[model samples]
Target: MLDQAQMRYFEGNYQACFELCLKGLEVVDENLKEKFVELAALSALKLEIPQALEFCAQSYHWHKNSYFWTLNLAKALIIQQNYAEAIKLLNAFMGVENPLKLEYLHALLRAYKGQNTYNEVENIYAILLKNNPNDLQLWLEFGEYFEFIPKKALGIYQDCYFFINQKLQALEKNTPKIEVLQTFAQDSLTARFNMQKTQKTLIENPEILNLKNFVNTILTQRIAESYLRIFESPLQEAQKAAQILYSVQDKNLQNAEFWFIFAHALEYIKDYAQAEQAYRYIFAIPNAPKNIANTAAFHLAYLLMRQERFKEGLEFYENRLAFAKNTTFSQEYYQIAKNAFLQDSKVFTNKEIFVYCEQGFGDTLMFSRVFEVLCKIAKKVLFAPQSALYPLFSAKLSKENCFANLEILDRIPQDFDFALPLTSLPLFLGLDTLEKIVTLKTPIISPTNKRKSRKIKRIGFFWHTDFALKENNTRNFSLEFFLNFLLELENVKLVSLQVGDFVLPECVENAGVGFKDWLDTYKVMENLDGVVGIDSSPAHLALICGIPTLVILQPRFDWRFGLYEAPKAKFYGENAHLFVSNPNDFSTKNTIIEKLKSIF
Candidate 1:
């Protein structure tokens, strides 16, 4: 019975082998228990069940080689999504070198992903790929990790294409030799080498053929995406990407991911009609990944929202709930957002509403304007702002109105009748529609009589913004760009709004006082004639204070700013000016300098 089970396992009949192993185990002696248990566990794993974990645990108890059994147990736990146990077991084996390290590392990759530990997943991928560049599954996993960032994924896929072709060429050249070497080997050692060589050839090894097909499919999808990264102009980028993709025969025909990228490129350029058709193409595909389909629907919703088709937009945005993985400040907030049961603004009459700040400080600053509107309707309003913005909110609102106490450590206050995130307020208030949004009041604050040296014609400049984002880093130009331009503008003093320590030429003066408090930052802006910077907290603060501001934008600017260059962003009021720079054109510097001179 045991011999039959071994034969079935070798023949790849996992279900038959699993049943036969169970029968073999029923009458197997103690000496043979470990072998039967390992086989049973492997078969159960192939069947995808908790039965593997039980059998692997039994194998671990009876096996002489503890490390092998522990590794198998970890693999079983990882398959079952019991990542904590898998992670613990993997960590135990991390420093200790063993022959099974490769298996341990791969299991660790899945465990990290299960725990949402993306940085570690990337780290492990880098290590694995460096050791074995021909590992197609490793490349696939790497590309999948960047699903949100398609351009990065495309780059990885291209690398995989290069590697796969190299491997295929090598395999093809060696195939004729493989058969001859196997038939004419002189001895057991020579025969063994020829057999290993045969197994490595693509013609003999079916796994390589399967991987080669997968690589071709991924390579086709990435061609369109890789082109989109060329940020010349919106229309130009989209057209270039589309044209390059269409040039490839059969590349665009049946590829869902290709259509998805092509649609986004069109969307970026505001070709709504073509973009919508491209998205619908992806949705029409019966075999498209659900997460990707939901994302397409999400983008379709965004298009409607951008076009001020509010009713249609809201429906699509809600459809994204099927895949929208929202991370809020708390589990309660996440649940509230996911459920979205009470999104109506009109429901909160004479009730205490707590509006917790979410996302970045720029978003919070932009949405803080809605607090006054909330105070008007709600019986009482509690403003729970980010730690950095707490001082700003306290100064803006009365002490009684602001809730500085962090409920993160304690229970969510049961006193509030309704709680909503700052970003969600626009949706609930029916302020998303263009007409309603146009009439929405711009927030203006009265100067607190705080001024820094009463500098009447001073222009505050900052080049450092959100360096953590790759896009934001591109927007941050050198200080030399400003210094070269400002050399002629002797009348206007340039005050650096950048917080970090750096040596600025005598041409520009640092603001000196670091903004430890929001009030200090407010006073500095109040004194300046205008603010000049990329998108940052200071820029947002300056706009809110009604300071004349000139914002330098990247070619692909943040969605808050319109896609194309305009004199101003209407929502932030007339004092704010926006200039979009073409990354390919160096002359944009002169244009920016001219705008800065005009604004100042």
Candidate 2:
């Protein structure tokens, strides 16, 4: 029993092992005290109990020579915010043979950070980085250290950047042999397979051509990381990182990691078309890593979703469930989404269907357009929307039932035989092509309070989006930047449609008697002559309301916004025009001003 308990502890069944250890402690032999103490401490730490420090202290006392006990004790101390004790414990290992490796060093770094010992932290970081130049954690720590001691780390940071740039240059030089490119073109496994079709399309597709140019020029991850650390704003840093990557050559198309990194960066910048191609390019190669292929397929599905290409997208999305481990979504939720499955909606005839809302508020609204179609097919339909969206959706979807609370996920209606996410509707309904999406009936949800206006054109603007999304930050601006341009316009009256963190300073005329629910927001949008904002909910709202909207796009705008000079936007309809901002080099202000100037 004791041996089994120890095995469970090593296997990371921490909570289960903790219970076993507690039960074992009552009857264990005297010689097993040290082992029990170590297991108890380790499990308690993993389970995050207050007794962890006490248990860890006892383990170290009983087994002083065991590095596991020492490291666990130090980690517990750090967790308990006992920086002094942790530093003291970590410092003791510094002089020992093969000391301060991996967890010990990681613990020591946390201790140093807790104690604000910048110099010692840098020394330790440098040591680990030198030992393992390719260690991502070490590189990330080095990058973080600059953020930690911004002013004092300037000279050191410059030297680090120079070294990293040189490393990137060397990595870039590792191009495939001439014959490899020839093989890729005609006889390589990828070229000989279905990828040959994609390769041929890429050669002629203008969108692919633009992306190929951008993808071929960017720097590697390490070089971009090193370069971006110089910028204070995370948004600017990501923008610069994307630009750096956009200028480098992917000389080694055969490199899997290289494609993954490049694809990831492209996604971050909202270059979905290119990102899709890059991800697909990875799978075309034989012997592609299972994990990478699955992840790429998952992201490719999302890229397609963003473009409203749901049928094929959901197929790929579902395919990724096998590899969907350690994600933010709960296991239960994952099982539900994974198990719900995709099929023709006609199969749900004479059946009850539960439609679940996934993703953000914007996504729910954008996809809710399909609920009416769903209700027409299923005999009984129950819709679960985000709590905040319930007020508007319930009002609009009153003919059909709607549940806002998440607790509904626990008991879903008793008779519902089929389930699907709101986003997956397009797929199951067979709305596969872009032409179908463009012609799909516009959603109708009447807003409660409509503004009665005069001759002056009502130009509405929303400046900020979710701050946590780093890519959205690139599209965001100081309200002042837009205000200055709008203030210069003589024929239009500016209205602030922005809410939450973005509504500060109250510079523009507030629309109506405040806003409530998506209905009120849409009503406000309905009265506008035009709307300007990033690729956020408000932009989607404006499109749904059939307002003339000019969407300000970052270099990597969402695929639904379509390419530059696209005749019509899939999501925003024919009334929308796009103005993509150049992040690293040019100003988007003049372009925006010109668009605003032409609006009247």
Candidate 3:
């Protein structure tokens, strides 16, 4: 039990360690009581429990001969704001003529600070820091001590910069840097803030005489970072930091850590051009850690890709390597593609090429038009598309359509020269520019489901995708959001192309329950005047069939939809309309409703 408690304490599980130590005290021997009391007190202090003072007092009382126990009790007294008792105990302990770590003297400084006694504080701190020049703990505590007093901390940071630089270098080169960064990335927040005046105040201060040189340069960066971490709330603090960084041009741009913070600030404010430039610069920095550089490289393309500049950004999309490890590559297929992925522009010319669909059915449908171009480039094309899409493609590309070389297959052949994803088609097809790629081919225009007689135009829409396809339901929504806009229109028949178990209003005719696969949905889509949906296969199929489809998306939508800036989809062409849904931006919803009214 004592061993378990000790292990928990060392592992930094303070609550668990404190609880285990309590249980241990009941069973431990007299000699072992000291360890129990020590772990319990230290863990309690970390947990910020009131019992920390009680346990610390007991530990100090029972272990009167120990140097560290005296310090622990003093720490508890300082935390409890018993400034006189803490000062008396610390001074007596210091008078014992025993050598101590710089961190131990910092406890005395803490006691002095509690009483607002600054007379000896600066002199003691400077002497200790000068003597213990290499003490990391002293430097960290010193930084923490004067957090709000940015000027004092800035002076110390400048004085002991060699030691600070060494510690930074060690942390930067740590083997676990990537894992650490990955962990920090799991939670993120956003808020609005402005820190321009802080810079103005720091510059204009008359008392900041000698500090002016550093303040205008490194000290400017230091002051901005100083009080940020004393939290007001996560979002507000995050904004304060980004806003603070925005006005901080004196920052060392060469530092990986500085670049990381600066780049994120640029992104938070939607200054994507500068953010992309910063990320690219970080990626090219030779001195930056590989993990940091790779992280910058990973997000470098998103700035452009998210803005619909895939032509310039596709080759730089390394996010697959950094975040979506499983989706990025499977060990089985990575083996083949790693060496032979689209070997040459004419690699498919008079040769057998294997094309597989790996992304969602919507992505497949969006990129499927390139397959016909693939057929034209190759003597024989071995296509392994989604099974649900097989019947539609096989029928569409039959001998009658003159696609005799294209073969839709259930199993990929072993003899194909090279393998590639359907999404990667443009890279090898020599459609090197975004313009050529978007216009690769028009969507499959089918003649079958066209309604000859049109009176009240029938419109089909679905607002959901397979739950597994979208994380956090970003691509799914309650059909009720659109019901107001959709149903309000005059001379329109609402048809639900939605599948699965869904509740629909009585006014909506449920056409989705009849669909077994995308082929069924495609057939149904042809009979409608148009379709509306989130980024799902049904909408992609509707758009591909050259039906006027309104793809309702969130502001930060799929790479295919581009952004709301231009509000045009060059690749999906004029038959397709993109509407990025933001609850605050009702103009888009109004536009979509007006577009629906015109169709009738």
Candidate 4:
């Protein structure tokens, strides 16, 4: 009965085998109790039965000396997330040289990882590699441990590919022996029989096929992802990733993950057309991973928007809501949830809406106009503005008296029908056309005081602005370079718009001292002739207030800026002077310098 049950399991009929094993365990002889229990436990695990862990525990309890059952019990504990017990059990077997040493190390790895002791996980990985240096699977496991920290993982994945390829080459070299037998088949019947048998044997060897799959599918994914992460060499690394991904069999056509990465690589390499096609392919797959598909949609939309295809881009942008969370913009950075946010095209007539602030101070200020638009549609609008700008928003919204339904809150409210990030308002309103979307105009914040007539012109200037983003450093130029250029101008008094512990020269008037809020900055900005700064909130404020604004944008500016060389952004319409700083083109900064001279 045990042999029959084992045969059923081997034949892939786990349900039948599970039933047989469960029935056999009740009537099995004591002399054969371990075999029946072990078989039942293995079958239960395959079928994912609740009793799998119980059976394993029972087997191990009966025969504590059995290494096989001990390993099984440890595995059960790990699966149930009882990491301490699993770690204790695995740790006991570590010193001895046993047949299941690798399995034991991996169990320890899982337990350590569950406990978040990454140092212990790394130690286990080091030991695994030291003992099994030539194993590609071990290298793959090591690479996955540093998934977010790609810089550390890239080398490990590359090494895995090297070893996997070597194994593949060895397999290819041995193939000629079978061919030799086939070549001499006409000379003898025995040669023909030998050739046929050898072919059958080779076909049955799943190890070689599995090794090739490691190179083609999983390894390709790891290596390409790592290549895409290298920021310094975006174009170069993206090209390499595209090359490696392209080399995969079947062109990775049916694989959503493959197509997603391929699309990103195409975008990086500036092949917009193929990138668009690759992104579209993932959307066609009905069963594609929700996160991967949504990400593909985002990249596709961004790619189109970069090329001035606004309506098409906006359509794709809406697809991202399928995976968006019902949370704050700041929480959206770290939180991932399924399509819980509003995406079903539900109308909000007579419904209370919860609008949360997203991104940064500049982004919040930029998107705050949407609240007024939202107020008209929803019966009651509960707006949670950024904490820093809460006082100013409360004050300003009160003065406008635009909507009796709108209420600004310093913190997130408990009751709301639906929620959205302020930036996502355009998509919710079905404003697919760029013309319908709101732009920064003086209406949002009219000048508090008209510009005073003076012999000397006052211009707001800032050389440093930090958003805590990865690409923020590239947006900043040398302060000395800015100071030298500014001090050279005649009849121009520079007012430092610098905030947060910035030291300014005596020649430049300090304007950001003891600032209560953005309203204080707005009061000072309203009196200035013009404002010039790197991509920052003050620049947004200046544009919205109808002040002449000169913004020095880095080459990798925000998506809102549109084309690289455009004189003005479509959204920052009022008094916008945007110049992209391209290091390759020396004239980029020189042009800004010329604009500064004229503005000052």
Q: What are the per-model C-alpha RMSD values against the true structure?
A: 12.1, 11.9, 16.6, 9.6
Over 1-600, each residue of candidate 3 has an lDDT whose tens digit, in order, gives 888888888899999999998888888588888888888999988887788999999988988867777888888988899978977877776766666545467887877888877656776777787887665456656665776565567556655555545555555455212321112222333112331222211122322322333334454345445423322232343455566666654455666656665665565445677777778778666689877787676566656776766666666653444443454334455446544544544545777777887666777787776766777767787887778877777666544343567778866677877677776676556555567666655335554554437777788888777653423114665676778588777777899998889788888899888877766776677678877777777877776677877877664455455543454665677767776665334445567787766544
Runs in model 1 with CA error above 4 Å? 1-216, 230-237, 244-259, 279-298, 314-345, 398-414, 442-444, 448-456, 467-475, 565-568, 583-585
- The candidate that wins on TM-score is 2
What clash pairs does model 1 have?
A: none
Model 3's TM-score against the true structure:
0.55
Ten consecutive residues with minimal summed lDDT in candidate 2?
402-411
Residue 289 of candidate 3: its Cα lDDT? 85
What is the lDDT of every predicted structure here? 0.68, 0.64, 0.66, 0.72
**Which residue segments of model 4 deviate by more than 4 Å?**
1-130, 141-153, 175-201, 249-251, 307-312, 319-362, 371-382, 398-407, 411-421, 428-430, 438-443, 448-539, 547-556, 563-568, 579-592, 598-600
- State the weakest 10-residue window (summed lDDT) of model 1: 402-411
Report the lDDT tens digits of candidate 2 across residue range 72-163.
Answer: 88889988989888888877876777444666777888888888887878877877777776454455457556753443344444455455
The digit string of per-residue lDDT tens for model 4 on 1-600 reads: 888998998998988887887778678688767777787788776676667788899889888977787888888887788889988987787778778888888888888999989789878988888888767767877998876567778987877778778877787677522322223445577556664432232242356777777678788988998877654545677789889888993745678998887887777677878989889899898799988988888878887877768778876775655654455543442222114434345556667887776457787777666666677678898887777777766766544555667887888788877677776676666666666655422225467554556667788887666663445224665466566556766777898877767567888888887577887787788779888787778787777677888887655456677643343466666577776654334434455668776654
TM-score to true structure, per model: 0.61, 0.62, 0.55, 0.61
Query: Using lDDT as the measure, what is the rank order of every candidate, best first?
Result: 4, 1, 3, 2
RMSD score of candidate 2 (Å): 11.9
User: Mind giving the per-residue lDDT tens digits that candidate 1 earns over 290-375?
Assistant: 87888888778766665557667766765544543344455465456435445553676666777775567777777666555566
lDDT of 3 at 285: 62
